[model samples]
Target: MHQQAKLFSLTDKHEQDAILQALSHFVSLRSLADENFECTWHDTFDWRLFAAKQQLTSRPHHQGYVATLIEKGKKVEQASVSGIFPSFANRLPAVSLAEKVQKHTKNRALLPMLTLEGTVRRWEIVDESGQPALELQVLQLTAESARTEQHTSLNTLLQLLPLKKRSNDFSQNFFTIVNGLQSTKSLPVDGLFATGAAATGLVPGDYQPWQPSGLDPQVPATKAIKDMIDHCLSVMQRNQQGIEEMLDVEFLHDYRIALRRIRALMKNFAPWFGSGGQKLEGELQWLGRRTGLVRDMDVFLEKLDILQATLPKELQEKLMPVKVHLWQRRDRGYAMLRRLFSSHRYRNLTAILTDCRLPEQREGDAEPVSIGQAATDTIDTAWQRLRKKGRRLSSRSADRDIHALRIAVKKYRYLVEHLRNLFPREFANLKRFKKIQNSLGRFNDASVQAQALEEMTRRLARSNDPSLLGTFQAIGYIQASLHQQQDEYRQQFFQQWKQLAQHMKRA
Candidate 1:
C-alpha cells in the first residue's frame, strides 16, 4: 500500500501558498480541482474504529452515499451503495473486513461521531520530464457536533499523496523543498478524524486509562496505594460504558483486569488502606462474581471454532448444537450483566469507591512505611508464598492444588508488574513468573473446559435433544483430549516452577 500522510497544523493560507510556490520551484505544479463536500465519520459507541486507527466515512455520491474505510490515513477499502447511512457491515467492500469489524463491534450499533463539510483545493506535481510525482491537497474543514449542533472550523490539512513509485531522490527533493519554505514539524492532532472530533468538542482518547506518573520511592505507603486505586478506578470508569453496551469483548476484558488489579491492591496492602478496606474488599469481590459468568462464556465462545476444528467432520457437525447452546448462554449472561451494571447497587458501589476517603491510621496499620520498603516487603512475601505453594505441586497433585498455585503465581506477577518501577533489577523475574503462569494457566483452562463440557452434556440430556447422544460423545472426546493436554502442561509446569524458584532465590 502507498503511504499517505496528513498535515493538520497548516492554518495560514499565505504559508500554504508559499509552500506550494516553493514546491513549484523544484518541480512542475498544476492545479487539479477545487470542490466542497460533506462527510460523516462513523464509529461504534465506544469508538472502536477510531481505537483501531481506522475511519469509516460516508459521503454523498452520484445518487447515493459512498462509504469508505480509511486505515492509517490511507483509503484501504470503499463501496458505493444507496442508503441514507448504511451499516459498515453492508457498505464495506470485502467480507473479511466486514466480519472483522462486526467481531469488534459485537452487538453494539454504529453511530456518527461528527460531520465535516470541507473544501479541497488540489494540485498535481511532476518531474521536469513530465513524469507524475505527487498530488498535494489542502483541505479546510468545518466540523459540526452531531449531538449538540455545535459547529467549529478546524485547522487546514495538507495531504501528500504519491502519484507514482516513490524513490529516495523524490523524498529528499520533496522534504528539502517544503523544509526550506517553513520549519514544518509533525502535526499536533493525530489526523483529520481526530481534528474533526476535537473541533466538535470531543477528545478522541479522553477515555483511555493513564498510568501513574511521578511516583517516588520515598512516598508514604498509604499515599502510593491510594494513587494506585485511583488510577484503576479511572480505568474502570472509562470502560464502564463499553462494558454496559457490550460494544466489544475487550471492554469487559479490560474492565475485569482493572477490577482484578484493584482487588489485588486492597488484599496485598490491606493494612495501608485501613479499617474500611474490608468492606471495600467485599464489594469488589461481589462485583467480580457478578461479571464472572459473562467473561467465562466470552472465553468459551472465543475458542469454540478452534476446539471444533480438533474433531473429525462427523463430530464437528454434531458440535453445532454445543455452539448454539453456548451462544444462547452467552447472550443471556450478557443481558444479566447489563442489568447488573444498570442496578442501583452498582451505582452505589461506584459512588462509594470513587468518593471513599483513606484512613489516617488503624490498629494494625504500618507506621512510617516508605513505598519502596512496602513494595519490597510485599514482593518478598508474595514470592515466598508462591514458592511454598509451587514446591508442593507435582504431576500427581489434585487439580485444585495446581489451581491454587496458578493464583499464587498470578498474585506475584501482578505485584511485580505494579511495582516494577521501584526495583528494575528484581522485576526482571517477571519473565520467569510469566513462563510458570502460562503453563499453569493453560492447564487450568483445560480443567475448566472439561468441567464445562461435562455440564453441557448433563444439560443436553435433561433437555432431551435428538442430537444429545452424538453431542455427548463429542463432548467426551473433547474432554479426554483436554485432560491429556492438561497432563502434559502439568509436567511443563513443574519444570518451569523449579527454574522460577531458583531465579527468584538468586534475585
Candidate 2:
C-alpha cells in the first residue's frame, strides 16, 4: 500500500453527506463498491503487523479467498489462498514486507487479530487530459459475530489515493475539502488496523523489556526478589534463540544485560540470599566473562568504523587486519556461548537460585525484612557509598579510581531504577541520575577503548602477520585520539559530579 494515501476518520451521515455534497459541486462522484466486502486480518501474537503499520488480510474472491497484503497504498494479492496465511511471509510477492515481518516478530507466528465486514465506496476523478488521475475510498467497517448476527462498528475513514503523480493538484483540492470538515481527523498507516483491533478488544506488541513487575513494599523478600529474577529469566529465554542464530548483535547484548541484572540484584541483596551467593556469583562470573568478551568485541566493532573514519583515507584500509581479528574472536565467543547454552549445567544455571530465604534468628536477623524496608535501606546504603567514593576522587584521580566511581554510580543507578517502585516518591526523581550516568559512561568507554587498543597491539604482535607495522601505527594513532577523549571525559565527569553533589545536598 502506498503510505502516501491519506486517511481521514469520519463520524456519521452528516460528515459523509457533507463530503459527497462538496464532491458533486467539484467533480463526478461514483460508488465503486455497490455491495459489502469482508476481510480477516492477521497479525503476530505480539501485533507485529500492526506495529509495522502493515496488514495481511483474506477477503472474499471469485469462488475462493485471496490474501492481500496492504501497506501504505500498495497492495499485493496471492490468488486462491484461504484462511489466515500470515506466518508464511516469504510466500508474499514483496521482499520488504517479508523482511519486515521477520524483523518485527522474529520467529513468532501470526494469528488473526479480527475479521471485518464493511462497505467501501470509491470516487474517481478524471484529469483534463481525459485520464482517471485520483481516487477516494469512503470506508465503513464492522466486526460481525457469525453465530449471533451481531456487529460492532469500526472507524469510518475517508481514504484518498492518488492514481498518478500527475494527480497532485486534484489530490490537494480533495484533501482541502475533507480538511474543512470539523469531524474528520487524519490518521497514520496503522490507523485502520488499530481501529479493527480496538473493536475486537485486541492489543498488540505486548512484550516485556527488563523491568520487574510492581510489588508492594510489604511483600515478602522471597517472592519480590524471585519474581524480579524470573522476569529477567523470561527475557533471557526470549533472546537466546536470536543470539544462537546470530540474528543480530543486540540479542547477545540484551542477554548479557539480563544476566548482569540478576547478578547485581543478588550481589546487592547478599544477606537475604545467604552463603550460596558466593557460589551463584562464581557461576555467573564464568558465564558473564564469556558473554562479556563477545559484548565488548561487539562494542569495539561498532566503534571501529567511526574511529577508522577519523584516520586519513590511505590509513583507513590498514586496520582491516584488526577488524578481522575482532570478528573471528567474536564468532568463536558465540560458538562457546552456544555450547554453554546447550549444556545440562545451563539448564540448571538457576537451580541454586531456588528456595533462598532471608537469614534466621541471629540478633537482628530474626524478623524477615519487608520488601519496602529492604529497598529503602539498600538504596540509602548505596547512596552513602556513592557519595563516599565521589568525595575521594580528584582531578588527579587515577583511571582505576574513575572506573571505581563509575561502578559506584552504576550500582546506585541500578538500585534506584529497579527499586524505586519499592520505595517512596523521594527516590522517584529519575532525571537526577541521567547527567551523572552519561558522563561516567562516556569516560568508562573511552578508558576501555584505550586499554583495548594497547591489548590488541600486543595480541596482534604475537600473530606475526606481515601487516603488523601498519596495524601498529593505526593502533597508535587511535590510542592517542582515545586518550585525548579520556582526558576530556574525565574533566566532564568532575563537573557533572559537582553539580550532582550540590543538587543532592539541596535535595
Candidate 3:
C-alpha cells in the first residue's frame, strides 16, 4: 500500500539518454535488466473498465504471462500462470483469480482496446548504506489501434516506487532529482491511460452527457431553448450505440430520460420555437413511446425478486410463471426496440435533430425576452401549477388526481434541474422538492403495481392454467399490500407538499 508517483515525458533517444545521464548525479543509480514486451488492454465491449477508471492488461512475465488490474494507477491485483497467455475464456480460471474482475466482466467477451509494444528500463536507487531505497521504471510505448491498424507513439511512462519505510526520504530525493533534471513533466494518476487512448484515437467516456456551465442569464430565450434541446439530443445520441447493442439497461433508461426532457422543454417553451416546435414535439413523443415498453419491463424485472419475496412460499412458486412470462415479453420488447433504433425513421429523426435550428421569429412567437426572465417566469408557473394540483388532493382523492400531481412535480423538477445553473443560489431547498417528488413517485408506483396485478390476474384467468387459483390469490394479496402502502404515502403527501411550498416561498 505504498504510493507510487509517475511522470510522463515525450522524449526521443537523445532526451532519454540525457535523462539517464542526469540521474547518475543523484544517489547511486544501478541499471536493472531491461525488458521488452507487447501489452494489450482488455475490457467489455462497452468499455466498462475504462469507464470505471480501471485497467486490465496482459503482458509477458517470466516464462508465462501476467494479467494485472490497475486502479487509479496503482496495481491492486494480479495473477500469473506458468504457460502462454490464453484467450479471456481460459485465462480467467487458469490464473486462480475469481472475484471482482470476474464478476464485473461476467460472461461479456473482452475486446482489446489498445495494443502497446514497448521496452521497459528499470533502475534501482540506493541509499548511502548501498540498500535499495526506490525503484524506477521507464516505459517507452508505441500504441497501435486494433480497428485501423494505425500506430502512434504513447510517449513514455516514468514511475517511481518507494518502499514503505523510505517514503518520506524517497519523496524528498525524488523531487530533488526531478528538480535537478528540470526537463520532465509529472502526470496525474490516469494520465497514461488518457495518453494511450488519445494515441490510439479512442476517446474513453466520450459519451457522457454534457452539463451546462457558464450560462449567460441575459441570453435570448430562443437561444437558451436551443441549448437545452441540443444538450438533451446529445445525451440521446451518446446512448444510441449502447441501446442498439443492448449492452446494459442504463442506455435505454438514459435515452428515454433525454427524450422525456426534450418533450418537457418543447411543451413549456412552445411559443419560442414557432411551428417547428410542434413537429419536434411529435417526434420526441413517438420516440418515447417506442422505448416505453422496454423501460417499464426493465424496472419491473429489476424489482421482481422483492415483489416475489413478499408472498408465501406456495404463492411464490405460483408466481414463477408470471416472472417467466414477463421475461419473455421483455426479450421480445427489447428485440423490437433494437429494430426500431435501426430503422430509417430513427435515423432520419436523429439527423433532423442534429441539424435543428430555431427559427428567428414567427407570427405566434412570444415577445423576445431574456433567458433569466424566462427561467424565473417558468419556475413560478410550474411551481404554482404543482401547488394547485397537490392542494386539490385529499385523503379520498382519486388515483388519477394523484397521478396528475406526480406529472406536475416531474415537470417542475425537470425545469429546476435544467435551469438550476442560472440561479444556483436561489434554489437552496432543492432537497425538499426532491423529497416531495419521491413521495409522489412511491405513491404512483403503488398505484401502478396494483393495476399491474389486476391485469396479470385477468390474463392468467383467461389462460385457465392449473396454477390459476394460487396465482390469483397471490395477486390479490399483493394488491392489498400495495394499497396499504399507498395509503401510507397518501397520508404523508400533504406534509411533503407543504414543506416544498414553504421552501419555494422562501427561495
Candidate 4:
C-alpha cells in the first residue's frame, strides 16, 4: 500500500522554515512553480457530499473550470467543465463526478460552500536516480465563506503531497518524526473538511432540520414544548434566505413543514402555552394560508412526471396547456408570497421565534405537568379519535367525512410523532400510519386539483381567449385523469386503513 501525506498547521513562518531545513537532511529538494489559484468547494445546503464522505472543489483551468472530487480525503477524479457551475446536479457534464452529485444531492441545489484564495509555495522531493518522488506545499490562504460574503485570513500551513512514483520510497514515518520535533500540529488525513467548516464558521454536515422526535418525554411539558417550538422555528428561520433567493423549491418545502410542526405542537398541547398562544396560532395560520397556493402548485409541478406517466404519450405532450397554466399560477403565487414574506408582520413573527422567549405564564398559574403524563394522555386521546373516525369511514361516506377522517389521522400522526419518545410502540407503527395518511392526503389533493382546474377553466372562459381551446381540452382530460386517480388513491387509503385497524386491534 502507498503511504499517504501529512498536512501540518503552523502559525509562524519560522516554524515552516524550520521544517523545510529539517526536510533537507533526508531527501534532495527542488523548487517547483508557485501556485496562485482559488479553489471553491461545493456541496448541498445540508452538506450532502460531506455526508457521503466526499468533497468537491473547482478551480479555474484554462478556458473552463476543473472540478475535482475528493473521496475520503484523497483526490480521486477530476472533470474540466465549461461555463458557470450550475445549481442543479445533472447540469454538470455527464461523468462520474456528476453522477455522485446527482446521487447525493437529489432535489437540492449544489451551493458553493468554502473557498481558499491565495498562494501555494511548492518544493519537489527528489529520490535516488534524480526523479521527483514527492512534493512539498506551503499554503498561505485567505479563507472565505462561500455561503456568505465574508473573508478570513488563515495562517500559513505546511503539507506533504506524496507523488505516485514515491509510493514505496518515501514513508509517513519521516512526517511523524518531523511533526514531533516542532510545536506544529499535523492535520488528520480527513481533517481538511472539518478544518474548512471551522475556518468558515459553517456547521458540520450532520445538520438536519429539527423534529419533535428530539424532545424528551421525561421533561416538563411546558419546557419540552418550548424547546420543540423554538427548534422548529429555527428551522424555518434558517430557510428564509434560500426562500427569498428562490434558490430551490425545497427551502419553501422545509419551511412549510417546520411551520406545520409548530402548529401541530400548539394544536395538540395548547394548554401548555399559557398566553399569547391564540394570537401566535392565528398568525401561523395566516402564514400557512399565505404560502398555501404556491406550495400546492409546487407539489403539483413536482409530481408532474408521475401525473404525465398516467396518461398516454400523445396526451402527455398535448397537456402542455395545463403545464403552462400551472407555471403561470405558481409564478403568481410566488409573487404574492414574496410580498407577504418580506412584509413587517413576517419580520415580527421571525423576531418572535428568534427571541426564544419562554411563553408567558398566566397570572395564578398552576404547577406544570410532566411531559410523560401529558404525552400519554395526548397520544391516547388522539389515537382514540383516529380509530373512531376510521370506523366511520366507508365507501358511501361523504367527501366531508373522508376529509374529516384525513384531518383526524393527521392530527393523531403528528401527536404520535411529537411524543414518540414516550411511546415507542406507537412510534414503531408510525410508518404504517404514514402510508395511510399519505394515501388520504393524495386523495384530497387530487380532488382539490380537479376543482382548481374547473375554476381556472371558468376564468379562462370569462377571458374568452381564442388559444384556450387546447387548454380547455387539456383541462378536461386532466380532470378525468384526476378523478381516476382519486378513486385509486381512495381505494389505497381504505386498504391501508384496514391493515392499520387490524394492527391496532391486535395491539
* lDDT accuracy of residue 277 in candidate 4: 74
| Model 3 misplaced regions, further than 4 Å | 1-3, 14-119, 123-126, 143-151, 167-175, 197-211, 309-319, 361-367, 421-426, 460-480, 502-507
Model 1: residues with Cα > 4 Å off, grouped in runs:
1-117, 123-138, 143-151, 158-210, 361-367
Best first by lDDT, ranked = 4, 1, 3, 2
Tens-place lDDT digits, model 4, residues 374-480: 77777877788789888988877877789888877777776777777678899899999889879888988888788888888897789877877766776677788
- Lowest-sum lDDT 10-residue window in model 3: 87-96
TM per candidate: 0.77, 0.64, 0.77, 0.90
Candidate that scores best on TM-score: 4
Q: What TM-score does structure 2 among the candidates reach? A: 0.64
> C-alpha displacement of 366 in model 4, angstroms?
6.4
lDDT of the structure predicted as candidate 2: 0.73
The residue pairs found clashing in candidate 3 are: none
lDDT of 4 at 351: 81
Decide which is better by lDDT, 1 or 4. Answer: 4
Across 1-507, the per-residue lDDT of candidate 2 in tens digits comes to 222677888866457877777677877665564557687777654456766776777777765566666765457434454443545555544566566556666645555567777788877877667677667788877875322234588767777777888668766877787777787887766566666666666555654555854678887766677877777777788778767877567678678877777887886777766666788789888888888878778788878889999988878889998899889988998898899899887777755554445453223666766777777777778789889999999999898988888767766766666776665443555566677777777777778778877888888888887867877888888899888888888888898888888978887
Each candidate's clash count:
0, 9, 0, 0
